[model samples]
Every structure is written in C-alpha cells, then in structure tokens.
Target: MIYLDHAASTPIVESALNIYIKSLREDFANPSAAHKLGKSSMKKVERARQLILKSLKGSKKDQLIFLSSATEANNLAIKGIKLLPSDRVHYSVGDHPSTSEPVKSLNSQLVEIPLLEGGVIDEAKFLESLDKDSKLVVLSHVNNQSGNHYDILSLGKKVKDKFPNIHIHVDGVQGLTKVETNLSSLIDSYTISGHKIGAPKGVGALFIKDGVEVETQLHGGGHEFGIRSSTVNTPLILSLCEAITAGLEDVITNNKKVKRINSLMREELEAADLGITFPFSLDDTSPYILSFLLPSISSDIVLRHLEMKDIYVASSSACSSKAKGFNAGFDAMKIDQSKHKFVLRTSFSKDTTTEDIETFVKEITNIIKEIKRL
Candidate 1:
C-alpha cells in the first residue's frame, strides 16, 4: 500500500529497528537492579537519555521523562500541573483529546483559547487568559489534524512577557523532527512521541525545564528523575534516540521534499476542479499535513475508496478515528457539517516519494469524478 498516513504513525526506520533488536537481545537486564547486567542496561538508558537531550538541544538541567506515548506525556504535563491549584490550566481549543481531556477531567477552571479560522490559537486571547494564578498553558506546536504550525517562539515570548511565572507546555508530537523547534529557551515543557518520528511505539518523552514543579504521575521507585516510576525500557529508549538523531540530521532536506510533493498534490487536486480548502494558507501551518474537503463525498467513503486502490489516508486524528460520527477536532474548527463529512487528511513523511504523490492524486481525481457522476 502507498501509505499517506504518516501523521498517524510512520513505519519504523531500519536503523531504529536494528537497534531495538540488538538492545533487546543484549541489554535486557532491569535498569533498577544493582547487578552487572543491570548496570549495563542502566548505562544504555543513560546513553539514550544523552542522545535524546542532544537531539532536542536540551541541557542536563532539562528533565527528560520517558513515557509510553505522547498521550501519557500530555496527561502527565496537564494533570501534574493542575495539582497546583484550581482554574490554573489553559489550552487552545484545537489540542488533541489527550491534552484537553485531562484538563477536563480535573474540572480545573479551563480557559479554552479561540483559534483563528486557520486553526491556530489566537495569541492575544491566549495571553489574556494567563494570570499569576495560571499554572500551565498547553499549546500544540503543530496541530495534528490541520497541520497548522503555531508560532510557539512568539507565543512563548508573549507568555513570558506577560506572566513570567506561567509555565508553557508544548505538545510537539507533530512538529518533532519535522520542523525546527528552537523554542527551547521559551518553552517550559515539551512533549514528543517516538512513533511520529519513526521510532517504535510505546516510547515517548517529556521535557520539563529546570526548576519546574510537576508532580509525578506514576508512583514507584522514583525513576525518570522521580517524575515517572517505571523501569526504563532501555531497548525502546535507545531505538527512539537513534531514530530521532538520524531523523533530525536530515529533517530540513526531507521536509522540503515532502513540501514539494504536498504542493504538487494540492495543485493536481485543484487542477482537476475538485473543491478543496487549504487551511494552512490562512495561518502558520506545517508542510507535511494537508486537509481538504471533497464535494459530494463522505470522508469515510473516500477513505474506503482510496484504500481499495492501495492508497491510505485518514479522516481525522488517529486517536479519535474509532469514535462514532464526526471528529470533535473538525467541530472545533467550525468546519461546516457537510464539508466536515467530506474532509480527508493526507500526511507525508520523508520516505513518501514523488511517485507516491502522483499515484495518490491520480487515484483521488478519478474517484472524485466517479463519485460526482453518482
């Protein structure tokens, strides 16, 4: 199949797979144990941590806590901070359910910032929500569904300018290893997923800036610098480190290639007279994700049709795909119900070739025309 669902999860890189296999075979000892085998495993975990820090341009002062997925990291970031006080949490309306749900669960007087039509949070509105009492402000650097990039550096500057004490938490799941994230100086906490950047699933990291007071989510042995308690999965961590370091090394060149292919796909769809809306044109957006509306078609139907042709894509966030009916993300964007029903998301990866784009466009064009005649 010509997979176009990189946003959901990319296939693990061969290098990462090799490291995973080797580590599983050689470093299977428990990191918490004090024996020689354990020490060797612990050493590998520490080395992986160093690689992750280097890849993220973080320092020893920054705390990198490994979790199962971005979802867990987000929950830890939000729920951990919410323990501070009531009504202290703020997040944009477009955040993944993982971030939004934890805040909702706390019933912590949430301040949902409005997003522009292009699906980016209004910085001014976000700033207005901050106060001395505000404990955390969670923002997704690049929205998962719309591919919209947020000017997090500018947002960070504004947040620090207004409320220097307020912590900024960024969910960088979509942006990690794809776009330049130089907000290390501005951001207080950042969340990244291993699978999104071609690492194995069930491995993710949370970056908490020095001196940030976040309560632990898991409670045993005080591992991950006392923030998370699980014994480190040395093999997965090493694989994640390898994938991220290798991915970031060529991210600039790879993103440009994907962007060109994305542009061609958009041009082809438009040239074929398929009704489409490119939301990113209205605001800061990522080049890797493309969401468009197809006239006279349901997203489910289109998805199935494409799959039948050996092409793969998505209708919304992978986390919410199993939910019945329309996605809450599209609803938040104010996508008209009719158009929402027709919306499809096509995500690109560095491995996505020009030939893949051409094939996708041709199949989509023919399918839409056939559907139009029905």
Candidate 2:
C-alpha cells in the first residue's frame, strides 16, 4: 500500500527501532531513582537530550524539555506563561489546533492574525494588530494543511524590532528535519514532535529560551526541568534523538526528492484539468505537504476510492480529522464553503519516490472520473 500521510506519522528508522527495542528490554530502570541502574538511565537520558539540542542547532543555554506531545508543549508555551487579563495572545490564522487551542482557553484577549488569499500570513495586518499589549505570538514555521511555508526568520526579526518585549513562539512540528531552519535568536519558544520525524508517538520536545519563564501546568514530581512534570520516557526520548539525528543525514538530498514528488503531483493534477484547485503555487509550499481542492468532488468519496485501491491519504489535519467542520486554513483563505468537504491533504516523506507520485496522480485521475459517472 502507498501511504502518503507522513504528516500524521512515519515509520521508525531501522537504527532508531533497534535502540528502542533494546532500551525497552534492558533499560527499564527509572531515571529518577537513586540506584546505579537509575544513575545510568539518567545519564543516557541526558545524553539523548544533548543529541536533540545538537540536532536542532539549539544552544546549550536553551532549555529542552520533553513532553507527551506537541499539544502539551504549546499549552505550556501559551498557558504556562504568566498572563494578565488585559494582555493579549496572538496566533497565526493558519495555526494547528495544538497551537491555537491553548490560547483560546486562556482569559487573555485572543487575537488571530489573518491570512492572505493564498494562505500566507498577512504580515502587514499582523503588524498593525501588534501593540504593547500583545505579549506573545504563536506562528507555525510550516502550515499543516496547505503546505504553505512561512519566512519566520524575517517575521521574527520584524516582531522583535518593533516590540522588543513581545515573546515569539513557533510550532515547528511539520518543518523539523524535512525543512532546514535556523533557530537562533528572535524565537522564545519552539515546539517539535518526534512522531512527525520517524520517532514513536507520545514524545515531543519544547525549546524555551534561557531567560524565558513558563510555569508548569502539569504538577507532579517536577520533571522536564519543571517545565513539564511527569516521569521521563527515557527509552522514547533516546529513540527520538536517534531518529532526529538520522533524519538529518541526507536532508538536502531528501528535500529535493520530496519536492520533486510534490511538483510532479501538482503538474499532472493540473494537467488533468479535473477542477483541482491548488490553494497556492507549488513553489510557495514545502515539499512535505500538498492540499488539493476538488470543488466538484467529495473528498470522503475520493478517499474511499483510493482506500479500496490500497492507497492512503488524509482529508484534513490528522489530529482533528474526526471533527467535521470548516478547516481553519481554508476558512481563513476564503475558500468556497461548498468546496470545503472536497479538500484532500497528502504529505510526502523523504522516502516517497517518483513512482509513488505517478501512481497517486494516476489513481486520483481515475477516481474523479469514476465518481462523476456514478
């Protein structure tokens, strides 16, 4: 079966899988315990943390804490911060639910930055809305639905220049390893997921700048440097580190390969003239994700057709796929509501091949034709 939903999760790398199994089998000691086995486990956990920092190019001064998922990291970034009732938290209009939901649950004035027609963040509008009261802003480096990429580096610089005190947070889940980004200055908090890059689920990391203070929401024995409080998943963390490090091995080449598949998909789909509307130009997107808009076809129907043929894809954010409603990115971009249920999101991984793209395009073409006749 051809699985084109890497945005949801990826297969564990062979090397990382080996380490995971071995760690689960032999290294079952709790890192928090004081015995010799505990000390050894703690040492391994710290080593894994160091590898993660190095892999992401984060500084030693930065605090890297593991969380159950990116959702918790995002909640900690926005909800953990000390906020006044008058303070405002802003999030990009195209943010993932994980990044946007936490802010919504807060008492602070929730501001949503608008998106341009093609799903690009309205930078000018965002700047106009920015003021001294906007204490924090959450922006995703790469959009999950449309595959639209953002120039966070430049935007972060602009935000810092205008409001030196405002905190800038990033959701880098979709961009990690697949896309290269410099996480130096101008970023206060960044969230990344292990599952998105071939590590097992239930392991995510948050990078908070040295001086930034975010209170812990999960009260427990006080783990993750007190940012997230819980027992450490040492084996999974080690496995995540290995996957992240290995995923970076041929990034430049991998990116090119994925982008080629994306381009090929876009080209043939458009050439088919089957009313497939690409929200943005192919070049404007990351190679990892592609959202196809079939205004005249039902995405659910199309999905079933592909499934019967042993191909898998997604209709919306994998995290919120069960919820039936308007998608934020599509809504923000003013896509026709009639076309809402027909949008299909397909994400490719470094392992996706040219033949995979060819088969996908061919099957989609057939599905559209078959559905119309029915």
Candidate 3:
C-alpha cells in the first residue's frame, strides 16, 4: 500500500523501534524511584532530554517536558498560560485543532489571525489582530492543513519585539525536524510530536524557554518538572530520541527527494489538464505535503477510491475530521467554496519514492476522468 499521510503520522524507523523494544524490556524501572536501577533510567531519560534540546537548539536553562502527544503539549501550552478576561489569546484560524481547541475552551477572549490566499499567515492581519492586552500568540512552524510554513526565527522575533510582555507558543509538530529551529528569545514555548517524524505515537515533548513559567496543566506525581504528572514513558522517550537522530541524519537528502517527487506530481497533473489546484509551489511550502483541490468531486469520495486501490491520503487533519465547519486553511486561502469539499492532502515521508508519486498521479488522473464522465 502507498501511504501518503505522513503529516498525520509516520511509521517508526527500524532503528528507533529496535531501541524502544530493548529499553522496554531492560530499562523498565521507574525513573523517579530511589534505587540504582531507577537512577540509571533517570540518567537515560536525561540523555534523551539533552538530545531533544540539541535538536531545538535550546539551552540548558530550557526544560523539555515529555507528554503523550503534540495535542497534550499544545493543550499544556495554551491552558498553562494565566489568562484574564481582559487579556486576549491569539492564533491563526488555520492551526491544527489542538492549538485552536484549547484556546477556544479555556480562554475567555480570543483573537484569530487570518491567513492570506496563498495559505501564509497574513503578517498585516496578525499585527492588526495583536494588541498589548494579548497574553499569548500560538504559531505553527509548519501549517498542518496546507504545507506553507513560517520562519519561526524571524516571526517569533517580530512578535516579541512588538509585544514584549506577550508570550509566543509554537506548535512545531510538523516543523521541528523538517527545518532548522534556533530557539531564540521571546519564543516562550514549543510543542513537538514523535509520530510526525518517524517516532512512535503517544510520545511528544514541550520546550519551555529559559525563565518562562507556564502553570502546570496536569497534576498528580509532580513529574515533568511539575508541568505534567504522569509516570514517564521511558521506552517511547528513548525511541523518540533515536528517531530524532535518525531523522536528522537523512533530513537533507530526504528533503531533496521529496521536492523532486512534488515536482514530478505537479508535472503530471499539469500535463493531464485536470482542474485540480495546489495551494503553493515547490519553493513556497514544505517539501513533504500537498493540498490538492479536486475538480468537481468530494475529497471523501476520492479518498475512498484511492484507498480501494491500496493508496491512502487524507481529506484534512485526522484530528479535525469529525469537527464541523470548513478547514481554516482553505477558508484563509480563499479556495473556491465549490472546491472546499474536494481538498485532499497528500503528505510524504523520508522513504516515499518517485514510483509512489507516479502511481498516485496516474490513479488520480483516472479518477478525475471517471468522475467527469459520471
């Protein structure tokens, strides 16, 4: 089967999986326990923490809080902030529901920044929406729906320089390993997940900038520096570290390959004369994901057609599929309302191949013809 939903999750690499199994069997002691075995487990966990910090280019002062998934990290980031009725919380309407849900549920006041037609965070709109009374701005390093990404270094700096007291939280699940992140000042927190980058599901981490204090969201054992209080998933943490290392080793080469695959697919689509449209070009967005606007057919139908042929893709974020309303990205991009129900996301992983793209293109071209005839 051809799986093109890497944005939702990826299969764990063999190296990472092997390490996870070994740790689960041998290093099963509780890191918090007061014994030699526990001390050893604690040491391994710290080592993993160091590896993760290095990936984010964070400092020793920065703390990495391991959570179950990026959703939890996002929740912690949003709900952890101390908000008043007068203090406004801000984020792009196009962000993953994980980012938007907590803000919607927990904050009394919210200001949603709109995106440009090309799926970019509208800088002018953002500035207009932001106010001194804002408590935090949640930004995604890579938008989950559309592949268009943000330059975190510049954007984070821009936000902080203008609003010194306001906080910046980044949901970097799609961006962390795909791009270089030099965590600078003013960026208060970042959320990253393992599954999106070849690590196992149910493992993610939050980075709290030095000197930044977000109130603890979960309570119990006082673990994770009191930010979260569950017993650490030691096996998954170690596996996540290994996945990071393995992902980085091939990141440069994989990016080039994915870019080539995108070009190939675009070439085929253009040649086929389908009315399908893509939100952004190769250089403008991520090399890993594409949101294709189908021609006169619902994406759910197309998805099922592809799946029956042993191919897999998504209509939108798997997390937000059941949520009512149109995708914020499409609405922001001003993709025609007629095509709204037909947007399907095709995402790639490091191992995705040219043949896979070719096969998907051929099948989609045929599907378009079949639908047109009907």
Candidate 4:
C-alpha cells in the first residue's frame, strides 16, 4: 500500500512506538496525583517539555504547553491573547481553519494577508499592513495545502522591527521537524502537531515566548503553567519527544531524500501528459507535499480509483476534504475557482521512495485514461 498523505498523519516511528508502549505499561500514574509515582510522571513530562523546547531553540524561560492537537494549541494562541474589539488581527486566508477560525472569533478588525504568485506570503505588503492597531499576526509556518514554506524568522524579525508590540503566532503543524526552525526571540507563540512528524495523534504542543502573557483557556487544577488544564499525558508526551528528536536528527538528510521523490513524482506525472498543472512553484514550497490539478476530472473520482489499487492520496486537507465549493485557501493562492474540484494533493514523507512515486504516477495515468474512456 502506497500512503502519500503524510500531511494528514504519519505512522508512528518505531522509537516513539516503543516509548509509548513502555510508558503506558509502567507509568500509568496521573501526574497530578500527590503520590511518588505521580511525581515521577510529572518529572518525565517536564523533561519531555524541556527537550522539545530545546529542540526548537526556544529559551529556557519559554513555556511549552502540551495539548490534544495543533488545533487546540492554535485556539489557545489566538484566544488567549487579550485583544480589544478595536484592535486588528492579521491572518492568511489560506491558513488552516484552526488558526483562521480562532483569529476570526476575536472581535478585532481582521486584515487578510495576500499571497504572491507562488503561494508565498507577500512579505512587503504584509509588513506594510502592520500598525499600532495590528495587535496580532497569525501565520502558518508551512501551508498545509500548497506546501509553501513561510520564512517565519525573517517575517517575524521584520514585523517586530517595525511594530514591536504586534504579537506573532505561528501554526507550525506542517513545518515542525520538516523544515529549519529557530524560535529565537521573534515569534510570540508557535503550534506543533505530534502526528505530523512520527508521533501518535493525541498529543501536540504550544510554545509561548517568555514574558508573553496568555490567558487561561481551559481551567482546572492549574496544569500546563495554569494556561491549559488537563492531565499531563505522560506517555504521549514522551513519544512525541522521541519522534521529534529522531526527526530533527535527520532533517537535512531526510529533506534531501523527500525532495528527490517530490521532483520525480512531478516529472513522471507531467511526462504522462495527463493534463496535470502544479499550482505552486516547486522551488518555493516544501518538498514533502505536492498538489496539482487534474484535467476535467473530479479528484474524488480519481481518489476512489486509486483506493481500489491500495493507494491513498488527498483532494484537500483531511479536515476540510468533505466540504464542497469555495476553498478559501485555493482562492487565496490564486487557484481558479473552476479548477477547485480538480485539485489533487499527494504528500510524501522521508520514507517515500522513487518506486512509490513511479507506481503512483503509473496508477494515476491509468486511472485518468480509464475515466476518459468512460
């Protein structure tokens, strides 16, 4: 089976899986409990948090809160900030709903950042859009659909240089462990998903810069620095840390491998003359994901045909796959509305090989031919 939808979720790595099983069997005690085992669990969870923060180059004083998913972390980042109704929030329309929706929920005036020809953030226009009223700027480190890598470091520095008080929050679900990252002292908050790398689905983390005050979104026994309240998921946290460590260790090498696979997939598909057109520039986007348009074919039809052959791809983000019509993300990227239904996305992982791309291209070519005949 060829699974090309790593952006949705990746299979847990072996190291993470082992840690998860061992923790589940041996460290079942709740971290909140006052007993000795609880203290041990709490220490493990804290160590995982510190390890993750250090991996991201975050400062020791910075707070990393583990949550159920990146969606929840985005919510905490957006809603936790104290925004007046008159303040303005800048966000990309192409960002994941987890980030966009929360920014919209705020009563602040909304400014939509524009995307350039290659789906990159319009850096000049974005910097010009900032002002004293721009209280928060929410951005995606990597676009989930188009795979465009936003240079948060450069963007953050520019934003901070111009408007020192404007808060910058980044949704790094698709970028974590997949691209070069340095938290430094520019970004205010960043969100990460465990499953996007090689960890299980039930864990994610939010990094809030030191001195950044975030209001409590979930109230309970004052867990997660009193900003988020939940039982410290020790097992998931440990596994996530393990996966992160492994992913970061080989980021450069794995990225080079994935780039070859991505380029090969595009070459084979384009050579097939199946009327495929790439939406974003290959050079500007992350090599891990590639989305293209099919010729007069509904991607859903081709998706089903591929499924029958033990292959899997995605028509859009897994979260919004079922929703029909008017994809704000596509629109923001200048993708024609008429071609929305024809968009097909096939994302890869470090493990994806040249053979996988070859098989996928061959199968897709056959599927298109069959549909044309029908």
Error at 297, model 4, angstroms: 0.4
Number of clashing residue pairs in every model? 1, 0, 0, 0
For model 2, how does the per-residue alpha-carbon lDDT over 323-360 read when each residue is reduced to its tens digit? Answer: 66576668887787677788898999887888888898
Sort by lDDT, top down from the best: 4, 2, 3, 1
Better of 2 and 4 by TM-score: 4
- Show the colliding residue pairs in model 4: none
Checking candidate 1 for backbone clashes, the offending pairs are 149-285
What is candidate 3's lDDT per residue for 33-112, written digit by digit as tens? 99999989989999999988887678888999998999999999888888888899887777888998888886458888
Error of 3 at 2 (Å): 1.2
Off by over 4 Å in 2: none
lDDT of 1: 0.83
Q: Please give the TM-score that candidate 2 achieves against the real structure.
A: 0.97
| Predicted model with the maximum TM-score | 4
User: Which candidate leads in lDDT?
Assistant: 4
Name the regions of candidate 4 deviating beyond 4 angstroms: none
How would you encode candidate 1's per-residue C-alpha lDDT over 1-374 as one tens digit per residue?
Answer: 89999999999999999999999999888998999999989888888887787777778777888889999998898878745446577876677888888878875667887776768677677778788778678888888988988878888898888889887899999998998876458798899899998899999999888788889889999898888998889999999999888888988898788888888888887887787666556236688998888775788889999999989999878887876556667667767555666778999888788899889988988888888898
lDDT (C-alpha) at residue 358 in model 4: 91
Candidate 3 differs from the real structure by a C-alpha RMSD in angstroms, to one decimal, of 1.5
